[model samples]
Target: ADDDECNNVTNICGEWANCSNTNGSYYCTCEPGFASTGQPRFQTNDGTRCADIDECAVVRQLCGPFSDCHNTNGAFYCTCQRDYSPSAGPRRFQPGSGTHCRGNHRDMANLTESRSMLAEIAAKTSGGELTSMEVISYVEALSLSSSWHFEGRGDMEATPSVINTTLTNLVEAVNNLVEKEELVAWTRMAEDLRENTVTKLLHSVEQGALALGRASSTPLQLDIRASEMELKLMTFDLAQDQLSVSMGGDHIQITPKASNGSVCVVFVRYDSLGDILKPSSDPGSADYSRFGGTGEITVNSQVPIDVDADVTNCAFWEYDLGTLQGHWATHGCERVLVNSSATTCSCDHLTHFAILMSSGRSNLVAHSNILTRITHEIQSTRTTIHKNLCCSLFMAEFIFLLFCSVIAGLLHYFFLAAFAWMCIEGIHLYLIVVGVIYNKGFLHRNFYIFGYGSPAVVVAISATLGSKYYGTDKVCWLSTENNFIWSFIGPACLIILVNLLAFGVIIYKVFRHTAVKKPEISHYENIRSCARGAMALLFVLGATWTFAVLHILHETTLTAYLFTIANTFQGMFIFIFLCVLSRKVQEEYYRLFKNVPCCFECLR
Candidate 1:
């Protein structure tokens, strides 16, 4: 049995396909289906066994010609799907190819349109039921302003699906909201636009404000509020107080009212130096305040050497601003007083009045501190010009040498020289009163020249240079008399720099003197006090120049007009500061004029 179980030998010729090995002989009965290669059909000692065979030739026609057919040794199969279709071509589905045919352009366009529509709908509805994409689109278009320029890149004639969808969504939302609340959805839309902080939004807001004002029951209050807002937002103050708003039961009317007060207030303030200071009093009369003069003077160029010393009203004065000297006097103002006498004069107690006569009682303060400082500037400029002339021939060789020199002087007086002198005067008073610096040496020689001459020389140089090269407008003289220079910028800057320097020096000196701990030891106890006074003067100069430069540089006026305006009230700042800010100056002011100062306590 062991030998039979163990393979000894087998024959394939066994009678059966199944065969078993024995020690000597082997017999094989019929096998199940196939016989092994090593076994004999009837031999007992034969080798192998038979295994079942799978033949699919019976299902030969399972797949049609659309598929390929494959047959194994005992099995066969066929694939007949569209993927394997013969007419589908080489690139359709291959061993290693990816190319495939797609639908036409119409299909793509329809797809894009649907996408756009969905996007638009989402935007318009902001997603009540619309797609999430539509909500995003609406949110993006909400904040629009004119600052952004739009590009028209898509089809011109066709309405974008996105836009259409958005509009539809918006309409639906409005209808729903309106039916629910009876509120105008359009107004809400406008408000939304306004909230976006866009330029167009803001502009719309402003227009809405105006419209609201027009529709309001009380417009005067609205006007006042609007005016106040404007003034607060912008640096320049408008002449609006003169305007009156009246409600006559039915309609509201707004109009300008002329100034009609008989009693005029002449306020006087001074620095410690007994110099008058200027301050903003009234916008209507901003051109003339304190020591400043307003109005125009014209020289008759056509007149052959006039034998008569008479100043008459100009037949044709220009206000067009384009022509030379066109901006001075249009038809000769009645308020203007053309005076031949060179004495200090105030016309009708108005700064706007032309000087026809010289009366020391100009109903105006000299703005003494400012004047003194300007005087000093003139002196400094003169020294500088002198130095420049000595050092280099540029001042002489330049065609505008004279013009520059004149402007330099003008700028000095107008800007710094005058203010510095005023501060010095303030210092003098502080020394005498507070610190008791009674050394007679304190009042130095050449004080007046330092205060006045320096500025004049500097202005003279500036004017000379500007006139020769830039233009033709005279300083301190009539425009027609000498077409020298109307260049206000150079002169104004030089003046500002000089005054700023002076102001800094005075402030530093004051702080320095006050820092000393031994106040009682020194005989010049007034040093600190003098410094304070100098600071007061500095304040006046600083204030005036700060505002004045702006007014001068503003290009709203022509050359002649600019020059005249700049010169007219240039000294008013110091005048107001000196007379209004200081007690001593106030006393001096009353003493000199024998009149009550305007709003004295308020000035202090």
Candidate 2:
């Protein structure tokens, strides 16, 4: 019998090679995906070796398009590229797995199919031909389609036709059901379900209008449940046309402009929709404490309405495709008419238009008073604490009279350095908030150079040129002599001014961005956020130096007090705004406190 060399402990084969035993002889051959260095077959002393063959390097288009080929030690595998996925099986596979890279189309396909089905349903339900069963089916289909998450712009673009068809069909269906005395069936559904249906309808309508993109020649009109909608397409010439749409005693008129482009006006009047979509009362909810009353078209009686109240706002549904959230916004639309019976809106562009009636002047006045009182109390407390702290620092400075000149020089350098870093912080903020491009490595290198080196150079030049003016009699600080104090004051003031300008731009950009991206946010909330941002910038950028400069230019007790308070409490302000208010820091604090024994005991 032949010796089984293939199964022996000390096989006569190199790694990745197969050993074969025959009539009193055995041969070694490299396995698939590996190559023999010396020969195809060898004996124990033939000096043959096996090595992995990089099949990916040798083969082109190994994984096909929209895929990447990765080489392994002995073989190669394929994976779909970003934004693409395999049609079947695992994400990574060999060539023979029958899997192919494909663009994400599942959401798009569902939306497209749903839209087609809706169009068919609308055609069948038109002209008072709707039944209760058919109405239920339509609602179920719309709800199911709306529940599918839209992935990107492609999905949004394919959705407008579905929404248009839905509105037209829904209005007709409801009207027919009412005429047949079958409306009570849907009305008897759970309030939450009814609200969800209406909300989804509103969301679909808003998204459709946003994604409409172009005007159609055909007109659309709908009225149901005390709500009405009229959509018309017209060639709007900036120089020659004024578009007007009126329905259900409400009117919209606009002077067409070049910027308005080809316009399509869609008007919708909702009755019970408002009752369902009321603003949330939960304090932690996004819609909590909104400036307006319930999201309803009717007038609110809780707050007084003036003859020229500005309480009635011309608004449109602003929908964010990314978040799939819709909010009533008054940015582009304006109220042209307001009365007891009806309100008219005028807009530069076209969308789902409506009227938002708010609680008027009393609320504004009350909020303002409360904010002013709180601000005053905070200022008084901060001033008292800062005054005592400054006095203590002043006394300590007098005690350090041993090296007055050295102390003054160090103080000048340190203050300049602090301002330099503030300037850098402003630049960093601008890059993050406004600038399109940001290179971390580049910023890191430049920040160290300018933040530290610039202050060092300024101090070195000042000490060399005006060393005698380093100390004063009253304090171990730079003297007010020969305009030499400018070395520190000049740079400090400039940095403060630059930072202020940067902050102004940042606030403007933030407001504009919020308006565009978050149109659902109320004006009051926007203003409050901007105010908080400005306050944060004031402390972080050391803008209190402006008060100091004001006192220097023309001394006043108020300016002196203001400067003292701001400068002394700056660190606390930084800590409060940057750390205490930080969401991540708050979460960390919660996690830490939760693990503490005292906290556990307290909870127990």
Candidate 3:
């Protein structure tokens, strides 16, 4: 009965076991990753606890260069080596560090590759072996001189020191290539000296690296050096872009060259015409006809033309370029010549002494050879043009006149005032006809102001204002061509508006006064002609303004003359209409013109 009863527990290990009364017992032990302590602490579960082990301390000197392995509680850290400072940029690492360690072999492989790549680049650039004593010296100097420093460092690194080291190394290579006699030989074979300088310099640099070994290897740093070379070449190329010439009253010949050494010759002929175009028996040929000459002539490299033999039309133009009478024929050199052709010559003209040059160089360069000469010619020509135009004196006078005219009176304002005077005249006429002036004393004063003093004030103001707007010109009057404001728009509109209103008012007064009861024949007879004359004057004023507006919109030179004619003769025309033609006014005008003094005592 006791044997039939069973237990559920079982002994599972030597120290720690599981027991089962009815089943078999088993032994238990700790795994290889764990270690056991002999002493057991009194706890609730009573399980065995083992501390983490440091394997690195146990296995020393196993990790390779560029890597460090560390052990912590239950963990370890393997860090990759850092070449540059953290602040310099991101670090180049073979494998990640911290927590997940890369194999030691992999880290070593990455470091070797990095070093090899750097060596290859430096070798290709300097045309020297990376391991050579000279190259190593310069590389060490560059590292010390670099403008970059380690993080948290105080002293600033020197960039120029590194550049100098690199430059010295490159210069040494250049000298080596030159000493080999390759540079001199290549330059001798090259056509252009400039090209030889550039090509030989470039090829020497490439050859320099080859001398240092790794002739077939390409380095990444070669791109940087090539870029620097390109920048230097471009700067030199732009420095010689333009071709300049100077024709100092002589004939010149020159050959121009491209960057590639292709030759082109340019001939230029400069002339001066002064006494030849003077007015004489040839009135029609004075101004425009004698001023005939091409402003400039340019041609490539060509043989020089004989000034004495090839020159034709009149001795003055015989040596000129592109003339109507004189022509050119090519003789020897491949030249672009500007020969004196009769087609562009002038008779009785003063011509500049021709300059003829024969050389395989540019006309502009050989002519403007000296910088001091360039300065002198520019200054002299500027002074001559100003003096010849008479502008030196004309400008001073113009400025003086402008100030005086403006202070005296503005012309356009006077024009408006003149229009106001015309209106006043119309009003005076109306008042006279209406018999509002019972006394004769007012007539003299009113007529003087309306006819003379008002016009004078208006004229003064208009003239002053006009002078300000016009500044200076060939003629004194305002015209569309000169861009004058007062003479064109101001006077034109003012005249039109004033005349229209005056005409309308007079017409309306005549109609109103005669509407209700017919005035006596005497009244009618006295005002009729005056009214007609007033109307005619207004019509003429309007027509004058209309023409001014038309000229402003469409500047016809002939119309400009018509306006001048109208302005110049207006005083006489007005006198005819307003004075001599008017029967009432004509008697008074004739008496005034006779210069006869009236005597009241004589009548007595």
Rank candidates by TM-score, best first. Answer: 2, 3, 1
Distance from true position, residue 137, model 1, in Å?
Answer: 35
User: Residues 255-300, candidate 2, lDDT per residue (tens digit)?
Assistant: 4455523444444444334333443321110110011101112221
Task: List per-prediction Cα lDDT, in the order shown.
Answer: 0.32, 0.56, 0.34
**Given candidate 3, what's the lDDT at residue 284?**
17
> 2 or 3: which has the higher lDDT?
2
| Cα lDDT of model 1 by residue, 128-200, tens digit | 4422222222323322211111123233222333323332333333222212122222222233231231222
lDDT tens readout by residue for model 3, 54-108: 6557666434343455776655555544321222222332223322222221121
Q: What is the TM-score of each candidate against the true structure?
A: 0.22, 0.34, 0.27
Top candidate when judged by TM-score against the true structure: 2
- Clash totals for all candidate models: 119, 1, 62
Error of 1 at 271 (Å): 49
Local lDDT at 161 for model 2: 62
How accurate locally is residue 476 in candidate 1, as Cα lDDT from 0 to 100? 28
lDDT minimum window of 10 residues, candidate 1:
227-236
- What CA RMSD would you report for each candidate? 33.2, 24.8, 35.0
Residue 356 accuracy (lDDT) in model 2: 53
